[model samples]
Target: MSTTIAPDRPARTGEAVPRATAGAVLGALMRQRLRRDRWQILIWLLCIALLAMFSASAIDQTYGDANARAQLIRLAIADPTIIVLRGLPQGTSLAAVAFFEIYTFLALLAGLMNTFLAVRHSRAEEESGRAELVGSTPAGRLLPTTATVLHAVAVNAALAVVTALGFIAAGLPAYGSFVAGAATAGAGFAFFAVGLLLAQLMNTSRGANGFAAAVVVLAYLVRGIGDAMGTPFGDGTHQRSAWPTWLSPIGWGEQFAPYTGDDWRPLLLQLGLAVLLIAAVFGLQAVRDSGAGLIPERAGRATARPALGGVFGLAWRLQWPTVLGWTIGGALGGLLAGALGTVINSSIADNPALSGIRDAIGRIGGGGSGPLTQLFISAIFSIIGVLAAACAVQTVIRLRQEEASGTAELVMSAPVTRTRWLFSYVAVGVIAVLAVLLAGAIASGLSAVAAGEGASTFGDSFAAAAAQVPVALVYLGVLTLVFVLVPSWTAPVGWAALGLGAFVGIFGGLVKLPEGVRHLSPFADAPVVVGDVDWTGGYWMLGITVVALAGAAALIRRRDFAIG
Candidate 1:
């Protein structure tokens, strides 16, 4: 009964490979990514350069005058929100303040690009199955990750160079320009590492992306909180209390203090953190199996629940995660708004300069102070709702992707009709959008109540939050139509619509763009409730939304499933 060992079975070595060979393998992978993504690399570099230059030039035009610079400084000193949002410059020069004010936003964009690029090439490709094919060859396990990190570094370096040049061209001091550029690059690298870490932890690329984005948002919030709570350095209040700002990654970047102290230590701290994160990522990868995550994928229901039999149920299933994500984000945004409102109200009572700016904002929003504040909060929430709608639309398009990928076939083979299947996802998306809006409204209402505003004020705020629904629904409809009629390009088209709407609705006024262009955004037609609430626009938006949705349903019904 003794068993003989199989001749084909090789003895286990129980030893790891040489470090030098591992290094070479990683280097090769990095080279592969660089070579493959050169086009995207170039595009990112170009975009960053252009954006930095444009921002610098715009700032120069906006605050070049001494009077304007003085006025801005005065206002910022009085308003904590402005300082927190824009940051503080050391000098009166347009370039100095511009770099200070815009660097955070620019860094955010750069970080986003880096994170997306890193994950898109690494985890995203892995999830999509392309990585398996690549890995089956002579490629090392760590090669792709190494390559992605390298790519991120190269791109960020390019961004830094471009930003530095832009600042120099804008007449900023050379040292300050260097600090600003490096700070931006450093921030990007930090987030790139974060994305890598997330990619390793999440089972899906989408989950990784969402998690990474949530981290970025948290970093921003932390920085904002720190900035809002921080005392002026020279104001003799407490010198030891700079701890909050010191803890934030964004704050660390800001601590480079660009035209001011030009502190280089914070940049070193950021770089150190990035290196640690990358090292952690590698360590985690070493312990985990390829294509597996640190967190195990949870087992979903094998048998569909009775409630999942219909269109509505399917819709809920598909859209719930996205709806929840947006709801959380909106609530956080509302909280931020509430905090800012508190700051603004206090600032208005104390500083004439802030009061003037507040009055100006009020006029733009259409008059009364209270109404103006409500309108401002509403506008912000509306934007959040629109983002939620975009998420919903993407969720719908996910169904199309599933169909294309043949996953839908499995579901369709079950006791589900095409109409029910499609409607289920559509209904979920719509409900998710509404949920996000409601969450935002509730958050704002709570904030208003906390701020000692009247119950009517809470009602007004919630109403404004609700008002965004129709506009968001219109976008959802457009996406649904696209998802039904032309599934291939639905994502790009849907995202583009959201981007265009945001640009036209939010920035158009600031840029003094034409009314017709502004009106193209669904939000443009939304009534301003600064002084008074107008129900007419709400009715119109509702009607338009209904029409668009109906049109989408009709189109979806008429079209055959292209994948099937």
Candidate 2:
């Protein structure tokens, strides 16, 4: 027999093997990541940049006079609620005011973007068994992580440049725009390291993502609290953050003080933290087994519970922890709404100039009453609606995950109809939406009463919560339909839609977006519970939800189970 040698194979198996260089491997991996994430990255970058540009222009238009900007600053300094919701007041300069109005939000988005990037490349790949496959090649384990880090750095660099250009395009000082960009990129890199380390620790991609996202949110809230507690100085338009702000990456971003102080030292703090975390990640990667996390998955029950007996029960079991987390977040928003609404109302009573702030909030929340308390409740609950909508979106995404992981095939192997399987998850989504809204309503009502409000506040709380229900249902139903029609686009499309809807619905009024465009957001159509209350929007949303859900049911039966 004649032996044929393959050109791509080694001349002899027992002889030395020719492996690719580490630099070549790293470049290949980074190129793969960029190609995979190009569209996602583009969307994120565009949204963030538009936010900066629009916010700068909005501030310029609304607070044209320095006196007006100063008054706005003084009001924010006095109202802890505003400070907690906005950002630390730097100064009354047009540039400073723009940075103060928008930087925190920018940093929050950047952090989320980076963390998701990290988790997706690390734990998610490992979970899909791709990491092990890569490990068996010249790329190996540590080199892949190194590539991820490099990819993150390059992405953040692009993010920084675009962000700076966005502000500069809005006619802010060029130098200060660059500084703001640095702040955003710095915070993002820090969060990226946090996600990388968590990926090394958590047993599953879902667990890592949930934990990382929670950490990002917690950092933002902590920074907000510190800013709200800050002491005003420098003509009462500048305030230094309290000590608690130092504890968060988002807080570190704020300390950059772009357009006012323009401090660059804070970048060092962010870089240092990233270095430490990245070092720890590399250490863990070297020591731990491939395709396994440092933390072990808990052993499952030897016998399944009664709740595992049916599809709906199994769906709830898998999803309740996520639902509970969102419910708690809604409850917290309610708690803040009730407690802070009273304090702000009293402040507004003493300072009539603050009524503009109240009015703007009312408009963002749709038509509402004149009382500052009522307007504040409307605004906060509008946010809670976003939370409930997010829960609904995630539920639909979970169904896609099950199908992609090949688990749906196993489930379908049992005596279960596809429509029934679809309905089971849909039912759980409905329950989760209701649970979040109900928790918020109850918490808001109790806190309002505790704050010495009248019994009627309960009516207001439930009404606001009820108005949000239709909005949440619309998101659930429509996104479920999307999932059924385009299973692969489910996660990306769902999150992007949510993010766009939230920005348009919550900040559209602030930016003076066109009325027709604003009305497209479900949040803008939420029912107003106050004087001459209109339930028309809610009724319309309910109709849409029903139609969408029915369509999803019809379509879900037509698709094959996906395993990707």
Candidate 3:
């Protein structure tokens, strides 16, 4: 009893031990992430490839003839909006010019994917406590960061390869095809590096994501402004200026010009900047503690107020920031649309080629004239509103999150009925959605009025924008039903539902998809104002909302709370 057992000791070395190389660490991390999330990654990549191929084939068929190409070029030069939205490349080849027009948007989407993935791997893991376990092993400090970068590199590589193959298969020149693909991948990599730097600086995942997204929005704005200024309409002829485009990363990528000038120097600058960003990440890692960031997290309130006693109040408090953000964002988007609409109406009168572009927008907007164009713009704005409503639904499901974390049990034990608690959050979501839609309507209306449009014009635009709310509510109801029935899988299901709706709403008309599939999107039934207001679709949308909400409520009543 007096004798003490000797404790087992870790192995000690007299000489310095060689750690794993950065590349080895990076490779292992990339493989692990790929193995864990292969399905999601594969699906995302496949979607991108399919869309690119579809776009390439469509352009080939649409503008294959010499006369068609000439018409398109002439029309593009005449409309400032067309040129800003889709750049005019100096190429006679239909495929090359099409690549130039679409590459900017594609590259932006690719960048978003890379940035989000990188942040999820590097920062989100640490926030969730998974990184601590990984770090406790023989892993070096730089290993996780290296792995994130390597994974991003692999994704970019795959994107580039797939895009290049799609273009080549679509019968484009090999050199130009490869150049376009590489430019997109290069831009994505640059943003991936930028995201890492943001992740290192911010404590919360939301903050990091918001910062990165803001940067992307800024890049797009810079490109738009530059393009607009460079080709201002004076005497019905197009002129190009270089200064504005020089300041934008997107513009830098575009300067490669796909098939036109085929410039390759700009890509080297992108790569160099990425390298500098990586070095900065390493320096940040050396200075900061594990599981923490350069920016300190604010100290939350030590005590909860009586108003925070219920689920609805708590939901509002948690979701208010995101709701405000989307509301502000949607309002700004509406204002921009109004401004653009005025420009289009004014500019189209003087230009003949520009006339065809309006016809195209009208067709997509369900084929009407003046008022219908405004309705089409309103529909686009409504999509943004739908997204905001989806965010609200997700916030309401944070109730489940709270329950799983053991906080809900304590609150429930303090004498609260489940129905009242659930409805509270639902009520808050309803209010938030209405507030956001109203904000958007007001902003768009003000913009229209400022542009010398009639007050009645504002009323019509506001009505069209608000009409999509019922469709959005139906989506929210469906998501809520999923949460009640299968809580564990609700997040993915909800996100997939939103993604499917977006695909159908945006691309169904563009591609020759089946009518049944397109009809499944709630947005497909949304009212579009061609010449006059269409109230028929509004009734159908309202009916769908009622059915979805009733189904969700019924499901919730039947199901027991799935919590510990």
For residues 1-564, write the lDDT of model 1, one tens digit per residue.
994332243212222435675576677677777776676556556555555565566567666677776666665555555555555444556666676556766666666666766677767777767777655543445666666777788878887888888778766777888888898898888988888888989887767877786777677666766766766544321121146766667778887777767788987888898899999988887777667888898898879898777656766665577678878877766775554565566556675555556643442232234643564575466556656766676676677766765667778788877666776776777777777777777777787778866666567656666667777777776677677777765644665466446544654443234567667777666665655566576678777766766776677667666662
Instruction: Give the per-residue lDDT of model 3 (tens digit) for 179-215.
Output: 8888878888888888899989998666776678667
The numbered model that scores best in TM-score is: 2
Candidate 1 positional error at 332, Å = 3.5
TM-score of each prediction: 0.78, 0.93, 0.82
Q: Is candidate 2 or candidate 3 better by TM-score?
A: 2
TM-score computed on alpha carbons, candidate 2:
0.93
The local distance difference test score of each candidate is 0.66, 0.86, 0.66
Clashing pairs in 3: 372-530
Candidate with the larger TM-score of 1 and 2: 2
lDDT of 3 at 532: 66
Model number with the top lDDT:
2
Which rank order by TM-score, best down to worst?
2, 3, 1
